[model samples]
Target: MKTKKHTILKKSVLIIVTFLILLSLLGQTDLGNFSSQDNSEFNYVTIQKNTIRYLQKGQGKDILLIHGSPGSIEDWNKIIDSLSVDYRVTAFDRLGHGYSSDYEYSHHIEDNAILTNQIIKQFNLKSPLIVGHSYGGSTAAFMAVNDNNSDQKYIILDSPLYEIKMQPIYMTTTLPVLGKGFSLLFSYTISDMFIENGLNDILVSIDTNQRNTIIKQRQHIWSQPKVIFNKSMETKNYNSDLKQISNRYPNLKSHFTIVTTKDTLKTFRKDCEKFHKEIPNSSLIYLENTGHYIQIERPWAVLNIIRQKMEGQPSSYKKQ
Candidate 1:
């Protein structure tokens, strides 16, 4: 009877080991073929212990672009050319994303803000305009609050400035041991599913070339465990970060131009309105029938608003 029990236990262990090995092999094949064709074009800047990857184009007043969660500098690919024509456009892959070194275990918004300020200082950017999208918007706001003495303007595009409810997958990835295991086993697979499912229904309106670029960028980042882990941490602690930002909201010195659409998450729209009400020297623009990816969906609207604000035009999008 003892021999029989031992035999059953050994068989079970063998089956589990076999399953893990197969899963690892599957993950390798499916996640390892990311194309590195566009990597050569990026420039690197060493910030503290990590190297940041960035792209710079054109020459004029500086405009820094910060991308959202699970994103890289390529998020601005569609509008960079046009924006760079009039401004020294610089877009960077935030830590752990794209070509940036994934040395950090946590990617809290405030840390990202500090990194951004470092970039601005390193480049000696003078009175630069910072444009942040989604999660990037949160970082921009935090940077503005902390670096009040810096002459900076901000344009927040469909950002979750106030609060965000964590998604199930993000929550699952925040677990200690289980999180790493899940990321290793399923991050690329989940990313593939998102791509197959049209990537949140926002990519349908984007141009094919731009959409492909964004997908390639996502593929590269999703395959990296550090990036995935950091993203999960961001989601897990997002609310606390917002609360910290809220305390400093009254002291922010930068002017802001907020562009948002009603079709986005309800919490995001509410937060944008709250931000406009609480933060001084800020204006909000509401776009009808648009998606959250306003940068790609309606680049002209964003550029026009930014140009008008920078050129001292009257703020036209004030809430009644």
Candidate 2:
């Protein structure tokens, strides 16, 4: 009886492994050409052995825009044009996102900060105001805290500063042997549906053109198995990374302009409040009814806040 049970367990394990292998193979078929955006319009430069793509326009004060996880430089599409008119706006695709080249090893928020600082140095940007959203916000904060330069200014938008509870998909994709297969399979099946739902959930309104552009940008996230896999690793590591960086927050020299939506998740709102209190010279602004993607929902308000910050005036706005 014991021998029979052992044989059955072995067969079940083999069957599962075989299924996973097959699933991975099937999922690989869909890995066709994927471009997050029209790379032709952007400028490319090599930094730290990685080819980075960035967009720079307007000519005044320097402003660096950092996007969130699974996002690209296109995340700033609505606000970049307006911002570039007044400031030299620079936006880029972080490693493994959009058209940026991916590396074999996992890159964290610290790496992002390092890469962005290099961009500032390489481009000769002097004392640029860094604006970051979500994960990008964390990256911006990381850059600000570690830098000795007191001139660096940062605006953090609804970013997670504490540990995050991993989502089911994230958990599945981080698993050992089967993770790659599962993520690949997920990409081929329900990935786009999830992306669409998430976009709808975040944005107040989405026209045909806006929807199409966003969908294309998001598609790059799941277009390759490794990309999705790296994303999952990022989600898994984010909380621990944030914890490590928390001690340095109090030492940050830059004034943080934290903008959060009233309708954002309770956890994120709480974090934003806590972060504002913890940091020395920080101001918190609450926008009503706007979802997580506040810039897209209310770009004008963001612009007003930037202007106010630059002019050293208090920016208070009524919810629209």
Candidate 3:
């Protein structure tokens, strides 16, 4: 009876493993043909063997906008028009996000930062003010630390500056071969539904119509299996990158304007405060009632801050 039970257990395990391998194989079949209908005017530039989609408008001192994870250049649509009116505003689809070409390397924040610097150089942007939101904030921070231009100004919006614990899904996708398999599986199975549900929470200040539009756009890029794996890698590398930045915070030379909403995660708010206190030339702003997507919810606030930075306004803490 014992031998029979052992044989049955071995068969069960083999069947389960076979089923998972088959599911992962199904997940590997690329189903995403992601497209952005609003990108008719967008242009592409190849760097490091990866093609990046970008948009530039208006003319003045340059302003580079770095968007969040699982986001595209369209994430800045609400403020792009206003900012582009006076400033040479530039935004792009980061590698593995939006329509940009995917790479097998880990999408670390530092890599994005290096890419951002390359964009600055490639586009001939002259000491432009950098505005980064969410994951983009980390990229901006890394750029500011590495670049020698002390006069460069940065506006960070609701970014994770400290080493906060990642979600279980993000953790699960960091495994070796299992990570890729899990990312593929998740992308094929529930990534769209997850993104749809998540939009409601992040885009709280937007109306139903606007929120629906964003949800559709996000669903397009995030449904790609490569994009899913890219995000997982970024999240996995976030903590180590921040740890490196933390050591160099005191020596940071660029002026920083950190903005956060009243309804931000407690961990984010705490980190924001800690980041503000540590950096010598950093200023913090708090906006009431706005959720995570402050740029979408309060474009004017971001615009006003950009204008202030352009005008050489002194950094000071304020509430909006």
- Superposed model 2: Cα runs more than 4 Å off: 1-15, 19-39, 205-217, 220-223, 318-320
Query: Could you give the candidate ranking by lDDT, starting with the highest?
Result: 3, 2, 1
Off by over 4 Å in 1: 1-40, 195-198, 203-217, 220-223, 265-267, 315-320
The numbered model that scores best in lDDT is: 3
Q: Is candidate 1 or candidate 2 better by TM-score?
A: 2
Cα lDDT listed for each candidate = 0.74, 0.78, 0.81
Model 3 spans with C-alpha error above 4 angstroms: 1-11, 23-30, 33-38, 314-320
RMSD of each: 4.2, 3.4, 2.7
Residue 310 displacement in candidate 3 (angstroms): 1.9
Clashes of 2: 0
Indicate the residue-level lDDT of 244 in model 3.
Answer: 85
The 10-residue segment of model 1 with minimum total lDDT is 28-37
Clashing pairs in 2: none
